[model samples]
Target: MHERTHKVNAGSSKPRRPAAAGRSRRAAGFTVLELLIVITIIAILATMFAPRLYGNERREFR
Candidate 1:
Protein backbone atom coordinates (compact mmCIF):
# COMPACT_ATOMS: atom_id res chain seq x y z
CA MET A 1 0.00 0.00 0.00
CA HIS A 2 1.14 3.51 -0.84
CA GLU A 3 0.06 6.78 0.89
CA ARG A 4 0.15 10.22 -0.73
CA THR A 5 0.24 13.56 1.08
CA HIS A 6 -0.82 16.99 -0.28
CA LYS A 7 0.35 20.39 0.98
CA VAL A 8 -1.37 23.77 0.51
CA ASN A 9 0.60 27.02 0.21
CA ALA A 10 -1.52 29.66 1.93
CA GLY A 11 0.90 32.47 1.15
CA SER A 12 0.61 31.85 -2.59
CA SER A 13 -3.16 32.36 -2.59
CA LYS A 14 -4.52 35.72 -3.79
CA PRO A 15 -5.76 38.18 -1.19
CA ARG A 16 -9.47 39.10 -1.31
CA ARG A 17 -10.74 42.66 -1.33
CA PRO A 18 -13.19 43.90 1.33
CA ALA A 19 -16.87 43.38 0.41
CA ALA A 20 -17.69 47.12 0.22
CA ALA A 21 -14.48 47.95 -1.58
CA GLY A 22 -15.07 45.29 -4.24
CA ARG A 23 -18.27 46.88 -5.59
CA SER A 24 -19.54 50.37 -6.30
CA ARG A 25 -22.72 51.63 -4.59
CA ARG A 26 -24.48 52.14 -7.91
CA ALA A 27 -23.74 48.56 -9.01
CA ALA A 28 -25.20 47.09 -5.79
CA GLY A 29 -28.83 48.14 -6.33
CA PHE A 30 -31.43 50.17 -8.22
CA THR A 31 -30.95 53.91 -8.58
CA VAL A 32 -33.44 56.45 -7.23
CA LEU A 33 -34.83 57.16 -10.70
CA GLU A 34 -35.33 53.44 -11.35
CA LEU A 35 -37.10 52.94 -8.02
CA LEU A 36 -39.36 55.90 -8.62
CA ILE A 37 -40.25 54.59 -12.07
CA VAL A 38 -41.21 51.20 -10.66
CA ILE A 39 -43.27 52.75 -7.85
CA THR A 40 -45.04 54.97 -10.35
CA ILE A 41 -45.88 52.00 -12.55
CA ILE A 42 -47.25 50.06 -9.57
CA ALA A 43 -49.35 52.99 -8.45
CA ILE A 44 -50.72 53.46 -11.96
CA LEU A 45 -51.62 49.76 -12.16
CA ALA A 46 -53.26 49.83 -8.72
CA THR A 47 -55.32 52.87 -9.68
CA MET A 48 -56.40 51.18 -12.91
CA PHE A 49 -57.50 47.93 -11.20
CA ALA A 50 -58.65 49.12 -7.76
CA PRO A 51 -62.03 50.42 -8.91
CA ARG A 52 -62.98 47.20 -10.73
CA LEU A 53 -61.96 45.12 -7.68
CA TYR A 54 -64.10 47.18 -5.29
CA GLY A 55 -67.00 47.45 -7.75
CA ASN A 56 -67.31 43.63 -7.93
CA GLU A 57 -67.32 43.36 -4.13
CA ARG A 58 -70.16 45.91 -3.81
CA ARG A 59 -72.41 43.97 -6.22
CA GLU A 60 -71.82 40.60 -4.45
CA PHE A 61 -73.18 42.07 -1.17
CA ARG A 62 -76.54 43.12 -2.73
Candidate 2:
Protein backbone atom coordinates (compact mmCIF):
# COMPACT_ATOMS: atom_id res chain seq x y z
CA MET A 1 0.00 0.00 0.00
CA HIS A 2 1.19 3.53 -0.85
CA GLU A 3 0.52 6.61 1.29
CA ARG A 4 -0.15 10.04 -0.16
CA THR A 5 1.70 13.10 1.15
CA HIS A 6 0.54 16.73 1.20
CA LYS A 7 2.73 19.78 1.80
CA VAL A 8 1.78 23.32 2.84
CA ASN A 9 3.94 26.43 2.38
CA ALA A 10 5.36 27.90 5.57
CA GLY A 11 6.41 31.31 4.21
CA SER A 12 2.99 32.44 2.96
CA SER A 13 0.66 34.40 5.25
CA LYS A 14 -2.93 33.21 5.55
CA PRO A 15 -6.04 34.88 6.95
CA ARG A 16 -7.67 33.24 9.91
CA ARG A 17 -11.36 32.33 10.00
CA PRO A 18 -13.69 34.56 11.98
CA ALA A 19 -15.03 33.39 15.31
CA ALA A 20 -18.65 32.25 15.47
CA ALA A 21 -21.14 34.48 17.24
CA GLY A 22 -21.88 33.70 20.96
CA ARG A 23 -18.38 32.26 21.28
CA SER A 24 -16.08 34.88 22.78
CA ARG A 25 -12.36 34.68 23.56
CA ARG A 26 -12.95 36.92 26.54
CA ALA A 27 -15.22 36.14 29.51
CA ALA A 28 -18.93 36.71 29.06
CA GLY A 29 -20.83 39.63 30.59
CA PHE A 30 -21.61 43.13 29.45
CA THR A 31 -19.85 46.26 30.66
CA VAL A 32 -21.71 48.60 32.99
CA LEU A 33 -21.91 51.41 30.44
CA GLU A 34 -22.97 49.11 27.63
CA LEU A 35 -25.74 47.55 29.71
CA LEU A 36 -26.82 50.95 31.05
CA ILE A 37 -27.03 52.39 27.54
CA VAL A 38 -29.16 49.49 26.34
CA ILE A 39 -31.41 49.72 29.36
CA THR A 40 -31.76 53.49 28.99
CA ILE A 41 -32.71 53.19 25.32
CA ILE A 42 -35.37 50.61 26.15
CA ALA A 43 -36.64 52.73 29.01
CA ILE A 44 -36.86 55.85 26.86
CA LEU A 45 -38.79 54.06 24.11
CA ALA A 46 -41.07 52.41 26.64
CA THR A 47 -41.77 55.66 28.47
CA MET A 48 -42.47 57.54 25.26
CA PHE A 49 -44.81 54.89 23.81
CA ALA A 50 -46.16 53.10 26.86
CA PRO A 51 -49.27 55.23 27.04
CA ARG A 52 -50.26 54.40 23.47
CA LEU A 53 -50.26 50.67 24.25
CA TYR A 54 -53.48 49.08 25.58
CA GLY A 55 -54.06 48.37 29.30
CA ASN A 56 -52.95 51.11 31.65
CA GLU A 57 -52.25 48.69 34.49
CA ARG A 58 -49.62 46.65 32.59
CA ARG A 59 -48.98 46.95 28.86
CA GLU A 60 -45.76 44.94 28.42
CA PHE A 61 -42.63 43.85 30.16
CA ARG A 62 -39.24 43.83 28.58
Where is model 2 more than 4 Å wrong at Cα? Answer: 1-27, 55-62
The Cα RMSD in angstroms, rounded to one decimal, for candidate 1 relative to the true structure is 10.5
CA error at residue 61 for candidate 1, angstroms: 0.5
Please list the C-alpha lDDT of all candidates, in the order they appear.
0.87, 0.74
| For every candidate, C-alpha RMSD to the true structure in Å | 10.5, 8.9
Counted clashes in each candidate structure:
0, 0
Best candidate (score: lDDT): 1
lDDT tens readout by residue for model 1, 1-62: 89998666687775556687846766889888999999999999999999999999999999
Count of clashes in candidate 1: 0
Where does candidate 1 stray beyond 4 Å? 1-23
| Global lDDT of model 2 | 0.74
Error of 1 at 47 (Å): 0.4
Error at 53, model 1, angstroms: 1.0
Candidate closest to the true structure, highest TM-score: 1
lDDT of 1: 0.87
lDDT of 2 by residue, 1-62 (tens): 89998566587566444676436844587778998999999999999888777566564542
